[model samples]
Target chain A: MSLLKVENLQAKIEDNQILKGLNLEVNPGEVHAIMGPNGSGKSTLASVIAGREDYEINGGRILFEGEDITDLEVHERAQKGIFLAFQYPVEIPGVSNANFMKSSVNAIREARGEEPLSAKDFLARMREKSALVEIDKSFMSRAVNEGFSGGEKKRNEIFQLAMLEPKLALLDETDSGLDIDALKIVSQGVNTLRNENNAFVLITHYQRLLNYIVPDFVHVLADGKIVKSGGKELALELEEKGYDWVKDHAIEEQTA
Target chain B: MTDFNEDKLIEEVTTSDYKYGFTTDIEQEFAPKGLNEDIVRFISAKKEEPEFMLEWRLKAYRHWLTMKDPMWAKVDFPKIDYQDVYYYAAPKKKPQLDSLDEVDPELLKTFEKLGISIDEQKRLTGVAVDIVVDSVSVKTTFQKQLKEMGVIFCPMSEAVKEHPELVKQYLGSVVPTTDNFYAALNSAVFSDGSFCYIPKGVRCPMELSTYFRMNAALTGQFERTLIIADEGSYVSYLEGCTAPMRDENQLHAAVVEIVAHKDAEVKYSTVQNWYPGDKNGKGGVYNFVTKRGLCEGENSKISWTQVETGSSITWKYPSCVLKGDNSIGEFYSVAVTNNFQQADTGSKMTHIGKNTRSRIISKGISAGRSENSYRGLVNITKNAKNARNFSECDSLLIGDKCGAHTFPYIEIGNSSSVVEHEATTSKVSEDILFYCSQRGMDEAQAMELIINGYAKEVLNKLPMEFAVEAQKLLAISLEGSVG
Candidate 1:
């Protein structure tokens, strides 16, 4: 069964059309890397799926676990195990990361009709998750993403993803602006959290991330639609050449 | 919080009904509907005060007559008719109860509705409670336990009679009878409040607290609180207050003074939840308070923590005078205003001796169409060498129509003094709220988390017994402002 199926999704921000008939499908145990150009609607897809209110969905039917989630709110989608790791994590001063994660974890537990964890158990789980991404113990007590370095912010995002344990994790440029060392830690964290019953969506602009976390399928998003799909080697080809080749060939193929 | 039905929550929060609005039915006594020498004499004579006390009240009333009401506060209200307000009103119990157990059941229920039943406290932890209704202290609890430690805790009136010298020495030493318009008014007609004195080198066994309830109509609440920590002693005091809802705004002017001797520490915290008017801004309490502390002798310390959530218009500045060498002063506050409420509160720190230090952390949250401001002053005299000061003031606005302002006055006469100040204004961002909501917490939980985080620094300063209540108060204060 498919974990996520977004069919003919049409969305926009104000007057401009951002997601024009974008369609995709991912089954359990699959890692799909959606590589796209700068203006391509890669982040918009993740945002709309996460139920951000900025964009208006003109036409679409998003089905998660065979249930229609087209009109579900953000938190409702979250309770259903859909996670969107933001590109730029919001900084909430005075709210320590430990407390933030505790609230989030307890909230999800309550939604699942599970008992709330005690403080000791919650701290233990938080420490375990922090160690997943090589996060220092001190960072957990500091304000959430407050005064953190760029690499630290990305690592923290992955740490949250590991803790949440979402069924379908959507990564919105999660690997952007990180050096080799930080990239390895983030990818290792993701790999550790991977399982057969869950799926991953890696949205990125480079094939560098694909080497660490190999994707089963590679799709090129351009002009608000997936123009081509192929094996993981397609990412290497696009890296060797530029994305202009994909756009030109797709246009010629469409005309023909 | 997990049961997430936003429409239902919004509907519930939007009803601007005051929870403690029901008036208590009890006999009452009044001095008169006016302010004059005769009225002051009546109040003091009724309480059977010492001769010097009457002289002090008369002096205060005479001073009050010469001075006009100060117009400097950033609040707009109708002119108050001093002659029209009942200067004094007290519950007339036929046979006044002798103890907390024997106190009037109706009175106990009235306080229980406000979450301050003395019986409950006696059953649980031994929190010494002084219940002040209208113009008199009804019952004081745990007096015997506190007395064993050489710590004196009782009503101000009782203190004046039992410990006359202590009261006479420290009563107006911190806040003089001629301090300000409200302070003078309070000194003239102040009826009942808690008074405490921890003996030298003795730590107060338990937290000392006072709960003030106003149930009389056409009356004003004037309370005076005095606390003194002798050498090497430590004490933590908590205060809470409420009033019945009425169509016409009532006057509340209170004066609180604290003195810490050498090597002593005094911690005073207040949770002021007076009735804030309805959403239409019809009626509430005008809470004008003057609270100050004096650090006398070397190495003394004073800390003030307050959570101000109610009152139609609040003009309060809890200040400290660092007169002792190596003395320390700190102030932590969280003032929240919603639905036509206005609050202009902060602290003043004066460094008079060498090596004195002060720290201020203020958090202001404004919702609906309210206005919240932080006005503070930090002064270092020439002799106050090596004085160090640090202040951080932050404001959070929930709605677009609400407002927040900061006014910091810093004076440095000592070239060796080091002072640092920081101020920031932030709105409760929808993005942040969405971030929390998307994590499965509902809007109310998200809002509460954000607000608690914003107010954590100040709330952390409060006594542990009151921190939970203060957190809940912050959430309740911002109920209808956000979705």
Candidate 2:
């Protein structure tokens, strides 16, 4: 059975419809990549799944581990093993990265009827996980994402994902502003955290990210709908043919 | 539907009481309800002050009669009728008691509602606290521990009797009673406040704090606080204040003075959340305070941090006077005004010694139709050839109807001195709100985050416990003032 599913998802922002009757599914232990143009509503799907309030779910249903979670709050969804790595992470001034991650981890732990980690235990775990992403110890003391470089911000997101250890991770344009060296480090960190019981939904506009972390499936979204679904080789094919080819093909199919 | 129903509705609206409107019924002593030489003498006699201190109070009262009320502030309020309110109110005199058993249970209940029950604070935080209810210092905890460190912490009335020589030498030396209108008034009829003295070469072991509340009706509170850090000593003092809401506005005129000797340091923090008036501006406190510190000896330092979010009309200027060579001074303040409240509050830095330095940071948040202003002055004396000062004042406006203004005065008499001042005013932007909303935070939470971020520079200077309370107070004070 599929671990995550979205059936007939229709979303609107204000008066305009952003996602019209979209459908997708991902099985456990599988990585699915969604590629689309700038206005094809890829980011909107990520936001809606994370329980952001701006977009209204006019009609649809979202199932996480076979349980409907359409009306949950952002933090509630996070507590239920869902995490979203923002495309542009927020800069929370005066709140240290380590402090924020600890609070978030403890929040989820408390919700699951578990005791909170002592300061000593929490610090030891943070030291080990931060080293996995090549983050310096001083970075944890600084405010979250404030005055951080673009690549550093993305790395911090993955660091949080590692700490939370979520079941369903959504990566939204995580490779948008990274250099080659930083991209490799981030990809390695993602791969290290992947396991058979969890799944990932990677949203990107380019196929270069797929070169480092291969996806099990690739879907092409056009005009708020998935126009084509294929295996991993489809990502390279679309990279060569470009988005216009998919657009024209969809129009042709509609007319026929 | 009948005429009797209309009468019931009017009665229900007129009888609503304030949340913190409970009063203690133990006060028995009070001076007359006017300002004169006789009233000054009466207060001094009631406290049983020494001869020298009584002479000092008399001189201050004589000078105050000739001085006029200051009108330089932008605040507008009715003239204060000094004769219409009682000047002093204290608990009935009791025999000197050794333990908490002798304390009145009703007074303890009042402190519990103020969130600083003596027994509770002692058990939970391990910090010694002195409760100053209405106009008297009721109880002080942990006296023996402070005595072991050679520190003197007690009520001013007790200090006058126990350490008369020290009181006589430093009482009016730093801030002369003739400094200003409010300070002089406080000097003449001040009832009681905390007095702390740290001896030479010793660091205070615990945080010294005082919680002041105004509970009596139609009474003006004139509290006088004095702290002296002797040579090579260090101390951190925290003060928190609140008042019961009243339909008739009450007056609060307070004077706080501090002196730091050679190689000494003093850190003073205040979270002032006195009752501000209702939405229609019916009633609140009129806070007029004069607080100043003097860095008297070389290598001494003084710092002041305040989070002010109350009072219908507030006029305060907590300043620092750097007198000794190489002394330093700093001020960090965050003041918020909502509804019909108006505040004209900031600091002053006077550089009188060569190589002296000072820093001033002010953050003001204005909402509703309120008016907030940052009025500061940085003065460098002619003899101070190498003085330095840096100042930044920023304002955040939440609603379109409010107003914020900055008035900074910089005077450098010495050509070798360097001074820099910057001021900016900006309204909360729509784009920031949209970004936060897209991240799943509601509008109220987003506003709280942005406001906290804007005031981070000043709020970070407060003690950790007070910082959290100030953040919550900032959110609650601006409720409904924002859309």
Candidate with best TM-score? 1
Query: How big is the positional error of residue A112 in model 2, measured in Å on the Cα after superposition?
Result: 4.3
Please state the CAPRI-style docking class of candidate 2: incorrect
Give the CA lDDT, 0 to 100, for residue A48 in model 2. 89
Which lDDT tens digits does candidate 2 get at residues A136-180? 999988887899999999999888888888888899999999999
Q: Candidate 1, after superposition: displacement of residue B127 in Å?
A: 1.7
lDDT tens readout by residue for model 1, B383-439: 999999999999998766778999999999979999999999998776787678777
Runs in model 1 deviating more than 4 A are: B1-19, B94-101, B481-483
Q: What do the candidate models score in CA lDDT, each in turn?
A: 0.88, 0.83
User: Residues A1-256, candidate 1, lDDT per residue (tens digit)?
Assistant: 6999999999998999999999899999999999989999999999888888777889988999999998887888888899888888888988999889988888898889999899998888888988999999999899988999889999988988888899999999989989999999999999998889899999999999999999999999998999999999999999988999999989999999
Name every residue pair that clashes in candidate 2: none
